[model samples]
Target: MRHRAGIVTDEMLTIPKWRFAVIGMLEALGVVTGMYSAAMLPGPAIPILNQTFLLWQLGFSALLLGRRYSWNKIAGCLFVAAGVVTAIASGSESGQMLSGVGLLWPIMMVVSSAFQAGATIIKESVFIDAVAHLKGKLLDIFVVNSFGSAFQAFFVLLFLPVLSNLKGIPFHELPSYIKSGAGCFFNVGASSGCDGSPLLPLLYIVNNIAFNISILNLVKISSAVVSSLAVVLSVPTTIYILSLPLPFLPEGVTLSSYFLFGSVILVLGLILYNVPQHNNIKHNSDSDFM
Candidate 1:
């Protein structure tokens, strides 16, 4: 991860604007991947079973830093859980099962999100420490992206057999609705069936560099608090769009009261989770961890 961040930092010297593009792409890829997973899963559960991991990530991050859990952070985790519930509640029991054993998509998203959130925390420490040591943001970015890619590459290669199955394959026919839906999961990479997305990994690299810049710029031009909230506006917009009648999303999929309730909770949780706390942070925070 450190290596990846370092490389990205170097690229900034040649092209600083790439960061914004990268951020937008990364955000789009994650959201698109997630929506695809929801369409593919049984009962079309959004947030699925993997929601547990995010909660765990929140807890793990807290423990990793030896920080006591504040009510806001705890509530934030709960809201993340609630968001998943809302997604599930909005789904149907009679949803379609995925054609192949492609469980890796959701798993990848969860794992990546965990790494991402943790890295965000750790990078801050690195950047601040770099200030005292005269380190640069470009170096820090490269280090994060490089290592993140390197570590995740193992999984990509390990899942080679699965990817081999789809190297030149085509997806089975999709209903016209899904094919045309704005939230459709078409054009999945043919790298592997289980989760062989060279595209995803590459996108991950590009995305880290991008959003990291967006956040930095956003904070630079304004403040961390403002940038953080601005980034979240996409959530409810996604939710609303997903709930609406659309040509691409399956017609049978319906959002329930429970799902809406859960979604609201999730929104709340996320809002709380990101709230900066004076008590939760301590001295000696570093870039190796967040």
Candidate 2:
């Protein structure tokens, strides 16, 4: 069907191979390092570190794309950082406060996120200044995502031995681990057995897919920094959900005053990030082409 629609033609398949290769390699590294960092860090710390990527993205975008930011945008970025820091500082689990292992973990996550943001910005730049017949056609986010994901899977598989060893799994057990994972994925092995309701995994899978799609769409319509800001704005929503009496959560989960204040500040930051001046600038640029 894709072939009939010219979507899978030989012409479409032929692109500047080096561009795709570079993007794919960065994406692969990002995925591997992100997984490693997530394994090493605490859950709450992960979001805080992930949110820091907004700064990296903004800086790199300006440097690489010569993107200009309004003063409001800069203020918004600062507010986001302050809000995240406030929430983290006031939490009960904030004892480490970037000391010892805590410092290392967040740094690793930030590096990983920088790779991801770099890939995002490069892809967006390609779309903004496309060449030849590939101008609009190659800008498809789905195509970019499919290629990036394929490359990520290949790299992950290539590094399986290293990753397994890092996790303290024996080399000989790697095959069994792969087999068990495949079996569990297919729901045909002992590993498939779940202690809780089956609906949980299904819901998780659904949510994961939806979340990925939403993020990719955001990156397509806007810049990487905006996409990161959108994710940052969701921190409060995640906190609220965790505070609820969920089935898997322990009882007595509650939000602190600092967290609430930080959430409010984060929302304001989001609003500032989308100030009318930004839209006006974008509108004027589009009108130039028209």
Candidate 3:
């Protein structure tokens, strides 16, 4: 149907091959490292670390894309980081801080955010840079996504041996481990650890794919910073959901008493970031008059 509809454009085809390869490689590193580090970090730490990507995104967009922001946007990013940290810290148990073997993982997570942010900025640049050559036509999201995914798969294959060994699995034993995982995913294996089985995993995969596509589309339509902001908005929602009583999950936990206070600060930061400043409005009015 896509072929019949001609969604693939000549403009998309004109994008440089190296661009896609770069995006794929960077994003692959980010995903692999991020997942590994996340597996090691405490649950409460995940949201806090994940939100740090907004800082990385802002930095990369400024450096790579040569974009400037108002002070409000910058403060908004900091508020977001502070809010998530405050909220997560409220529920954290004593001795839950990253230390010992866990210390390196937190650093890796931050570095992973750098990689992801760099890739996202590059992706945005692909759209921005293409506008001139394509005569204002934007590149197709699928074209970027498909090539990036293919390259990411290649990199993931290359990283598998090292990744497995780092996780304490022998390289030779990795195949069996993956096979056992597949079996468990299908619910046909003898392993009793497969609780939700194929259904839950499949649903998770579907939802994740949709979420990623939406993020990419958002990046294409707006700036990389905006897309990162959208992702940041989800942190509070995730924390709230985690506190809810839900089936197929452990007993729900409550948010820390500080959650409301942090949330208010977060909301204020968001409002400040999004609402146009008086100077900006005056400038826009002057431009219109001229």
Candidate 4:
């Protein structure tokens, strides 16, 4: 259906195939390395250090796209970084400190995040380039997403051996392990001890699909940096949602005092970042008057 609709064809793309392949490879590398490093890192450090991706996105947008950000926008990004770190570090009950884990994993996590940020920027560039090259026609978001995800899946298969080892599953047993996991996921076979089964994982899969689609659509209409910032803003909301008592979860943890303070800072940062550039607005108004 997508092919018939002209969404999957190369004719819609502005960039060459090799360049798109490179972007796909970047996406795959980012996901694989991010998962590997995250598996090694402690729980708290994951969120705290992941805030680096925002800065990386901002930097890449400037360096690669020749986009200049105002000082307030940069500061707003910092506020967001600090707010998330404060809320996550102080609120989590277990392993609240990052002192135990060594520096290697944390460094790897940041690098992996940079890879993802680079992919995001490059994808945004594809959209921007398409406008000029496609006779004002916009590229379909799925063309980017489907290809990127297909590449990622291919890379995952290639990296399965290493990932299985990291996950403590024997390389040979990986297939069986996944089979059993699938059985549990579907609530079939003799897979015991899978209480939640299909519901939880289905919800997770659905939610992830929706989130990625939404974020990719956001990138289609806005700059990559803006989409990244929008994701950063979700940290507080996720925290709040997890804090609430839900049917599926055990007793939900109450929001800490740090959450309130950090949320305020996060909101302030978003506001600061979104403040319009005076020069751009004045130029637009002048054009309108003319």
lDDT of each: 0.48, 0.71, 0.78, 0.78
Clashes of 3: 0
Q: What is the lDDT of residue 151 in candidate 2?
A: 70
Instruction: Count clashing pairs, candidate 4.
Output: 0
Over 4 Å off, model 3? 93-96, 99-102, 278-290
After superposition, candidate 4 runs with Cα above 4 Å error: 3-10, 13-15, 91-96, 165-169, 190-193, 280-290
Q: Sorted by TM-score, highest first, which candidate order results? A: 3, 4, 2, 1
The C-alpha RMSD of each candidate to the native structure, in angstroms, is: 10.5, 3.9, 3.7, 4.0
The collision pairs in model 2 are none
Q: What does candidate 3's lDDT look like per residue over 239-274, in tens digits?
A: 789778877866897676788777777777777677
Error of 4 at 238 (Å): 0.7
Q: State residue 113's C-alpha deviation in candidate 1, in Å.
A: 7.1
lDDT of 4 by residue, 93-183 (tens): 5453556777787888898889889889888888888887777888788877877777768766877788788778888897788888889
Q: After superposition, how far is residue 164 of candidate 1 from its true place, in Å?
A: 5.2
Q: What is the lDDT, from 0 to 100, of the residue 14 in candidate 4?
A: 38
The candidate that wins on TM-score is 3
lDDT of 3: 0.78
lDDT of 1 by residue, 213-246 (tens): 7765543333332333344434444566766766
Provide the clash count, candidate 2: 0
